[model samples]
Target: MSEDDRTRAMRSPGDGRPLPQRPADGLRSGGAPAHRMPGGGPGAPTHQLPNAAPQGPPESGPKPGGSRVYGRERSGSSPIKPLRSRREPSESGPPSPRGPGRRISGRTVLKIVAGVLVVLLVTVVGLFFWVNSRLAGIDGVLADYEGRPADTPGTNWLLVGSDSRKGLTAAQRKKLATGQAAGQRTDSMMLLHIPEGSDKPTLVSLPRDSAVTIPGKGRDKLNSAYALGGPKLLVRTVESVTGVYVDHYMEIGFAGFVDIVDAVGGVEINVRQAVDDPKAGLKLKKGTQVLSGSQALGYVRTRKGGALPDFERTKRQRQFLSAVVKKAASPGVLINPFTAIPLASSATAAVEVDSGTGAFDMLSLGLAMGDSPVTTVVPFGGNEAVPSGGTAVKWDRMKALALFDALKNDKPVPKDVIDAG
Candidate 1:
């Protein structure tokens, strides 16, 4: 065949393109044969079209030492790069600069703390309202009368302990040795004076058997005022006698007294002497010890210890009351939920306060009593026989007047009168 005809026959039949000429060295760039010979032998020339793009250097192939370079290989067309994964960065370059991760600022932290405090404050406020609402109020106990004593410099509270069996069951009354009394009478009375200044408070006991003039009832034992006219008449009688205004009134019955004493666990008391009184249901040893509810009630009520039984009873009452107030206001009781809740419940349920008095006033009373108040009793002359009210104790007029005057003007009691009592 002619040379031109043989070359034409070497062209690709499908595209009618001429094949590439073998280089003179008879090898590819990497020293490998480009294609197979006509009979599938080595050392054949690679095919290429005349008008095709010029080939560049080999992008990947075997190297001089038989190690291969890994990359995109070139053809008559442009090189195609391998696809990269979205998660992985390119190994051919440094990773792109990234922004810092999110962080919490100081302001944000403060906002979180403030939110927590607000929630706690709301909870505390709600608890206060709930507890305050439980207080039982008595109406018109401190009503203004025509000749009532004028308001004094400091606060005065008329604290009355009544022998009312309103809440006590038969078994309880029997246990407490409280007879089946139909109507209630004042078992004990006290005037608690809280000075506005830094002076310590004063607690003065009013013996129930003392002779005092009850308005519209003439002269009789002081307790007869309460038995005849209840709280209103009793307050009037006390104010008229002492010349000191009564700002608040609180009364607790037998059952209430017991409940309160037990609620604070018990009250610590130092007994002056041993007493065994079956009538008052009190039998105690002399020493510093704690008294339970029933024992405390009897301890304060028994008139069997000193030569002047009633006088000694009044001292015991004052001593016990102050100790109880201190216990109720202690951190151990106020901060502990178990004791605090029960104490609050018992206290609020146990006492009847004037309409004007509230939980805050009671709190003030507790705080005042916890201050270790100076305790005394009305200076007395001697026992007397009253035609209408049996035997009654008589107060020393001059000394009693001086004591009440000091309290009315918010001045300290004269040391002579304090010692006299």
Candidate 2:
């Protein structure tokens, strides 16, 4: 070989120069010919076709680090483009606030609480209307008397307890020891007066045997008006005698009274003395005792033996009525729907109210009674035998008038009237 050709063949491949061609036979130490380097050496030109029709896929060949991706060898400049998975994000850092696995905040909890409260309020309101619709309403139970006393300053409610066995079954009658009374009569009567602006409520019990002139039936026992013309005449008679207007009237009968007592479980009362009365089937010992429905019925009905029979009985009726109000308003009954719903149903079904009395009026009466109002029986005067073979009660006229006046004018009842109890 010539000196210059030999020098070219000995040059390193890094010189970016082509190797000198070998002899026709082969390299001196030879086997097969060596492959050409990529990005051809300096002496060899880099061929470029002018505006080549987007060249087809490059030919396959072995690479140094890994298999060739296209025509280019795997290198730092030529990255292996990763194949994307369906679940992986296109570009990533951290998840968004509304994305999966977000934490709950206080505002969210408050919103949830508010939503629940609104739902409960709506439910309670709906339930109230449904229950109010169930009330038993009456018409014209109040008399339309032109001579009726003028309306007074406070609200007046005349509450009556009747001895009516109209709805009692044979078993119930036997259980309650109530003989089958053919007709209804007032066994107990009272007036509850509530003055405006938080004045104390006064509960005045009217004796059934009070000597009063009935509007149509003159000079009869107070209870006789109820038997003759029902509630209208009774209210009329009371109005004429007391000179105090009757704003609302409420009454309950035997079966209904018993059911209400039982529905509230029972009423607790303090009895100062022991009593055993076979006529009313009331057997009780002194001290406080909780009376069941049947026992309580007898307690209010018995008027046999006491200092004054009917007067003492009226006191007991007042006590029991007050206890009933307390029990119906108690937390255990009011907070539990099971107890509250049935008790309200029993009370509304049991009572007969005047035409003007609405559901709200009844509820207001109940709440007022629950306050443990000042309870007193009418001032007693004397007892006289009647032509009808029974005795009539006479009221202490002047004192009674003063008591009614205090109530009519919304004044505190005279201490004398209260002390008389």
User: RMSD per prediction, one decimal?
Assistant: 10.8, 11.6
Extract clashing residue pairs from model 1: none
Each candidate's number of clashing pairs is 0, 0
Alpha-carbon shift of residue 347 in model 1 (angstroms):
0.9
Which digits, one per residue and each the tens of the lDDT, describe model 2 over residues 1-421? 9995775556637675765443323222212333334655534422233442322233356445553444445533556676787556558675566667567789999999999899879866776786577666667777576877888887999999998888889988887778876888998999999888677799999999988878867777899999999888888888889888889998899888988888888889887788888878789999999998888999888886687888888888999998988888788987677888788788877887876777678778878888879988789788777656677988888789889999889888888997675
lDDT of 1: 0.86
Off by over 4 Å in 1: 1-124
lDDT at position 308, candidate 1? 88
- What TM-score does structure 1 among the candidates reach? 0.73
TM-score of each: 0.73, 0.73
- Lowest summed lDDT across 10 adjacent residues in model 1 is found at 65-74
